[model samples]
Target: MTKKVCLILAVVLMSQASRACDDNKEEELAIQQSDEYFARAYGFTPETWNTLYHKPSSSLQDALDVSPYEGRTLFKRPQSSNNSFKKYFNRDQEDHENHGRFAFAGLGANIVNTGLFNNRYTPANTWRPLITLAKRIPISVNPNFNNPLGSFDPCNSNGGESGICTSGSVCSLFGGRPSGPCDQGQVCCINVINSCGSIVTLNNTYWQTPPTALRSPCTLTVRMDPKFIEQKNNPICQIRLDFVSFTTSQPTAGTCTDTFQVGGVSNEVPTICGDNRGQHMYLHVPLSSNNPTDVQLLFNFASGTTISRSWNIKIAMLPCGATYLAPIDCLQYFTSTRGRVSSFNWQDVAGARQLNNQNYNICFRTELISSQKATRMCMSVCSATDGDAFSITTPPAVLLVASANTGFASAVTTDAMEAAQNSAVGATYTDQSRANGITVATCLYDYLLIPGGRDANNVEADRYCGNKLNPSPGSVKFQNVCTNLFQQRVFISGTDTNVQVCTPIRPFKLTYQTDGQETAVDAVPATNTIQALADVSNTGFCLEFQEN
Candidate 1:
């Protein structure tokens, strides 16, 4: 019985092995078929190969264990190499690209008829240019479109109508007339929006223009708050009364203030008013008042024609009480020699202040028509020589400890002034401390007088101590160098003239000897050449005698 059983077991094992061999052959054929199908469709084998089979082993890994099932590994597919697989795929891609290039070249050559064409077969073309660019780019985009001004939403939705709203309007989805509007003489309009998030319209014009006669200047009252003045340098406000072309002076009772004479010749003229030439006028008012005040405006014109207009202005107060005060005395320098105030304005908010508390915040303006020259008076000072150079220098005070108890003694005037006014006002008070000398005149050149004598004919060149030479050809030319000394004591003798330095005196004063002279006029130093003296007046100097 045991022998019979062993024979049967051998036969069964042999049959099972044969069946396993047949199954392995079938799986190999299936893998080959799959590979053939993938190559025909996509030009490369499929990425993964899988088959389902039954195994007597308890786990899939046990069935796949190559150590136990050596020969049964079966139906081996070719393993792929990095280069070989890449080259195989790349060849198909190259073939597709070549097909496209061939088609493009065939079409282009047919159209243009140039020879040896790969693409774009024009006579001058060598190779096709490859195009490269992004179809879309990243950018910053503002997509909000609710407000026309492109600002925050113009809506106010507070519980109270007047609380957050500029005027007495509510932000209602059902837009209609607002209830409880502002009082009479005021209009409600929306000026700002609040957090509650609704549309708000407020009422009220900040200020209104009053009616006045044409061609005449009228004073308008303004209501200003003291808080406003605290915030501005000059608490003053400017306004425009009207535009006038001409004006005349009002006649004085007796001799109309005889035209302010030079040699006692009654030279008075009538004051006229009004012009249609369309010039602008300005008036200034102080806006520091807590209450409103009436502004008094004086109107004068050249012609009888009248003009009426209004001006608008904005006002704000400076941060500190210490405001920038313009030196009124310095303004005198800018006045025209012809004797009229030119139209100039200042908008430095840091320096404005209330005029007298009487003038309100109303815009101040006047008709600025160009006026004719005013007659000037001649004051004669006999035999007053004119060669002294005016000089000014400041030095930083040295600190000294006189007593152990006290800090530095109260600073001197120059020290105090410089400490108060630094470069904030653009004044070089500190730099003046390091300078050495005061002004001493080298040669006489009169800035106050008109051109005179032979010296006026001198040809000015870059001289060391003398003024920057201005080229004067005819009578203003200099035959020889007045003085070739190089020093810091040069004088500005005339408004349009320059400095002249020398050792020995010319035949006469450069004004009289070089330029030409009259009995009354001579060259005098008007300003310090070392300091900033560009803005000096020619008004106060006198003329002793007149010559033709």
Candidate 2:
């Protein structure tokens, strides 16, 4: 082929241009049917004609020697890619994410017999095979669906319309009309399912304060506004309380005896609401008041049948220095009003306080919700004495001392007690001092709970010895005695098996069975049975079984 024709062919092959943003390169080509480049050069580019005619073996040297346009063949095309077509196709993942690479020369040339024929070909004819291969096979490409004219996703205060793509189950924009927003009073709820299988319900709604449950009248008074009685029947507005009981696999004693005190001197009685029920229900306080004019509701959950209910109206606090004789016990009850007492003032014993002139209202709450149910006996509220005002003395401060010997020993003692309680055969508790670097001090006060007396005993045992066992005074006949001390009440038995002897724990009264099998006192029998022993000094004593 002539040099001019070779140059023209090279220019035409290089005319192909890649489109903007389009990786596939293809451009129109000028096919010269009568041009010397095609007519004289075997109707093909110089290299193609040379390769077809000579069929070179090695470095194209033999073809160059035989070719008339050897020197012009030196014009190079863009570097052909080394990666195979299959390799490029393999890069695609199932998720449609990939960076593919392709080689056209090897596969394209082999398919169409590219170098075997010499023809007057245009750029399209030269690259037609490669284009066909690419078009025939599908490409996994991501398509953009975003709309530039408007916001694609609609959202409401409620979490319903949240994600970009909607499942139709969720509210979303479909036709032309927009989806409505969330309603008032109710805030949006975020549905978050966490890894631990907990569904967290998040809401914008909030309350000024959390509601409190009233187990007793005292609890109701302490937690609620004294005037909260007005909201008695309001369903959503009313405070709700409940009681529940169930029989377990075995007839087990409850954690608490369900007993509470009334006046300072009276023995604590089992709450009525707890009768035949394992759990007790009472009042719920949604609001509370600070003014003295308000009257708080007192509900006694007596035996499941009888509920001793009353109203204790509070009197305003008086000036701190005000003088007056005590309100007499003879005038305790009020003459008029809804079976309510007239004007009455609670004394210091009823946890009363003298109002300070600077403070307009006196505020106090029940220590425990259960305390609100029972009425507290008050001291005489008397008018000021002519000469001097009476002053009640306060109890001294209690100081807890901690030393190396006591601190270390207390922990050891607690663990030992826990271990003994957990054993099949209760552990024999001896007050022997164990030395592990230091002597530990275990307060006997908490180890055992005394149920018989009015005062709760919290005395620590003498450091020298463990604890001494004392019996209940009520168990004895005739003779009157003050078994108010810790020794005379409840005592820690062998281990976890705590036994109430003569004076059985109030709410958990012993069902004495005369039948030999169900007797209160029994020897080591077979399975599923327990026994107790009673004495004048100590009632409800237990013999803990020892493991073999």
Candidate 3:
């Protein structure tokens, strides 16, 4: 404003007769005094301001004083002062609604790309929440709660670990410790949940063992907030628990001493105990739950036992219809086409022991998206060099006797003493050892089922148990190495030398089931407390699959 405008206000209300004329003369005089110096005070207006707003309202001669401007001011142009707020931040225009980055984030929905490809492809996953995100978010609010802002940034830490990316104030608000730096002036907040009975809502949250040793049961609850659920555009389908480091009291004879189990899931997860490092599980989540779902991971330690225990499990929430999503009902899913698959409690401590009463399918990735093609897949046991690697209680060969000399008859002898004398089938042994391979007997209980397994010549195969997964039903002479290399493969469709490891058809899956009745040495009985076979505690199957 010019000094003329300031001086004109001083002469207000002179006399009714000369007031009008006096005011006009005084305003003109004031403009002449300071108009040249302060006229340029408006300065050069930038394009952004010009597009969103108008110029200063008038040229020099119109007024002697200026009116003030405000944010969200209800005053409009032409009606109120020239500098009154427009539609930018003022929002005084009743017809306008909310629309911006900050506004859409609170609405919680997947962005719909109607024009171009979505996931960076020619035609990406064009899955959108509703008809359009813009229509739903404007002037809308979540019915459950208002404050739905949360931080679930999985790509936040080193070594594949994860943390939440949010402001320090939000970190403190959620009782999280601000760690590394994040984009947009935010911090990588990590919420280390060590206490039992604590709820886990953030994806990639870590559940670690308590600092001080306590025999009490530890439990971590999981549930999604409505805001988070909607933002994902689908309900939680599976919860993957990655055991980065896990060690507890090993199972005692098929039963776990210190158990780790999950509840409130649609599918079943085995209760296991032992050293299971670098293993993961895909827990099935229930469909609906009044909006948010609830799942619990529970651990129990048996009392009156001296055993070391520790665990660091990373929890991941997978929404429905997501990329790299595992098949439903699969207990474990291996994404990489080339990786080893281990049992829940299977460890290398005491030779190798398979957990009893385990019934779950382990899936391998067969179909790759985004131009990745892989049709042929194969799984092989530890290897021929490691003789002790294959042990699943396969029945004895009916043709080969303790010695190759006695042929054309059941290798198993009637007298237990006589069988041991010839190293024949049904021979009792103290230590863990392979029994016999390629037997005609059916494997009813405690066996690994590799559906449609075959040998080099495509000979049909069946359930494999009792020691080795021999490729063919050849005599004991062929059991050694140099047995055709082509036979030792379990294919995406077929093939395996000995120890039976198979799958569940398409998508390439293997089912490992163990009935309560294990191989009983005393006549191989199904039920009752019969003596367990000498190979009761033997190395479980350790097979590797490759995608080609």
What are the lDDT scores of the predictions, listed in order?
0.22, 0.20, 0.49
Instruction: Residues 1-548, candidate 1: write the lDDT tens digits.
Output: 89976775576455445444354454354344434432332123222211111122334465466332111222232332323213112334443353222122322131122111231122354443221111121111112111101111112223222111112211221122233332221122322221111211111111112343333232222222222111111233322222222222322211111111011111111111212122222232343444423232223223443333333211111111111111111111111121212111111122111110011110111111234222221112222244212111111222211232443333122223221111111112222222473332222222221222212334332111112122231121111222233111111121223223211111111111011111112224584332222111111111232111
Candidate 3: lDDT over CA atoms?
0.49
Best first by lDDT, ranked: 3, 1, 2
Q: After superposition, how far is residue 111 of candidate 3 from its true place, in Å?
A: 24
lDDT per residue for candidate 3 within 320-358, as digits (tens), equals: 433334566578866554777766665444444667678
Name the 10 consecutive residues with the lowest summed lDDT in model 2.
356-365
Candidate 2, residues 107-127, lDDT tens digits: the string is: 222222222111211224344
**What are the C-alpha RMSDs, in order, of all predicted structures?**
39.4, 37.1, 22.0
Q: For each of the candidates, give the backbone clash count.
A: 89, 47, 23
Who wins the lDDT comparison?
A: 3
Give candidate 2's root-mean-square deviation (CA, Å): 37.1
- Poorest stretch of ten by lDDT in candidate 3: 68-77
Question: For candidate 1, which ten residues in a row score worst on lDDT?
Answer: 354-363
lDDT of 2: 0.20
